[model samples]
Target: MTDFSEQDLSGSSFDRVDLSGSTFRGVDLSGAVIREVDLSNSRIRAAYFDGVRMHGVEIPDLEISGEVVRLVVNGIDVVPFVEAELNRRMPERALMSPTDVAGFWEAFGTMDRLWGETTDLARTLPPEKLHEQVDGEWSYIETLRHLGFAHACWIGGVVLAQKSPWHPLDLPWDEAPVHEGVPWVRRIKPDLHEVMDLRRQRRATVAEVLDGITDKGLGRRVTSATPFLTDATDLTVADCLRVVLNEEFQHRLYAERDLRALGAG
Candidate 1:
């Protein structure tokens, strides 16, 4: 339940203290000694961890979705584990609630509502902060496109098509997908204005597509890895659309977060 992220945790120690679902964005925790940390759902993105120490730290299923993460302790570099995961986590987390689609709607609705407050921040943020670094750098605008491409290509094309009614229509993003599961390699980074326009259009249009679906579409195996298979053994078409909504809204929320960082929100 603790929310303080940047405080001096150098001498602090805890057991059974849940730091999950907490976001420590751009905070300085370089000198902290994190012990027995349950960072299961913690968002440790781009925080300074130069000299941080780890002892008895259990990081099972850790998802380091940060821009830059250099884990060096005692002046020795510890290689962060990497795997070709379908996703870093289970896809069926959408089923965590009574209504499968509620989470997606909640996240996207707030994004749409708040984006108007910070639309100007995109212009104010420095090019370096927004679009300088190769890996870490991404503008508020580009991030949205990156997300839309993933949704329209991978999740929508592969996951939804495999489970739901296969339309097999021509895509604006790619030719026939490379394989049955993966979207064909197509650099879908359209021009900025065009990208944004299409994104908005897709958002509006996907609702109709989603409305005509049912829960059985989730019956097919859609994820790129295991663990999720355990939970997603079957899915309804409606659940599949809900999953798409959930995925899209997650990116929208991420875009809103970056937007607010520039004091736009």
Candidate 2:
């Protein structure tokens, strides 16, 4: 029940240990064998991972948030360390099968990392930068606002439907909320550091809210309701979740472009 962080546990053989919720910051997890390990809801930041040995480890989806050191796949240099970790852990399971859950976990890692990068850019940027317009289009703040609204409209609605007796049938895209006044995209510029911290915190919450989903919950039907629909329909939880990730991918692409145009190029 003790927090073991930033300690030199090198040449240490950690086995059958409650490493869950214990951070391995700047610790080498290379070839560290773990039997029945539970890394659920743990954060690995600034950790040096040559590769850790895991057996029957219950790793509940990792959310990334910055520069990763290395990820060797069969001794090949892969992109992100967290992505490589998920790929390593991908297997076959029933409740939220290994494949589907792995996909979301991988994306969650990437999403966290991207939020870090983009939020860093936003923080360094002044209001003049975010407020800059393109072709009479939305400013960067407006763009983020749009992304936030879409997240709520799509993910929020679907998540609620899954929890309620009546599941969501469709997204009310037309009546979706607008993006403006977001702390990161506020009318008045904020302290760049605060912006970065707030953005990271917000993104983490959003990702966690979606990551807690189980396979059973996903396969079940959720009554979907939309303003455009005369009646709601039952939608598979997986389908609803897909809508959230798909929207995220698309919106990220747009946000990236707009931010790049605003001098983060």
TM-score for all models, in order of appearance: 0.41, 0.45
Where is the poorest 10-residue window by lDDT in model 2? 163-172
Note the residue pairs that clash in candidate 2.
96-215, 145-179, 167-222, 167-223, 167-224, 168-223, 168-224, 168-225, 169-224, 169-225
Q: What is the lDDT of residue 79 in candidate 1?
A: 44
Cα deviation at 111, candidate 2, in Å, is: 1.3
lDDT of 2: 0.50
Query: Top TM-score: which candidate number?
Result: 2
Estimate the TM-score for candidate 1: 0.41
Q: What would the per-residue lDDT of candidate 1 be over residues 106-194, giving only the tens digit for each residue? A: 54455455444444555566544544223243555556555555445444444445332222221222122244643323433334455
What is the number of backbone collisions in each predicted candidate, taken in the order shown?
A: 12, 10
- Clash count for candidate 1 is 12
Model 2, runs deviating above 4 Å: 1-99, 162-212, 226-234
User: What are the C-alpha RMSDs, in order, of all predicted structures?
Assistant: 15.1, 20.5
Rate residue 95 of model 1 by lDDT. Answer: 36
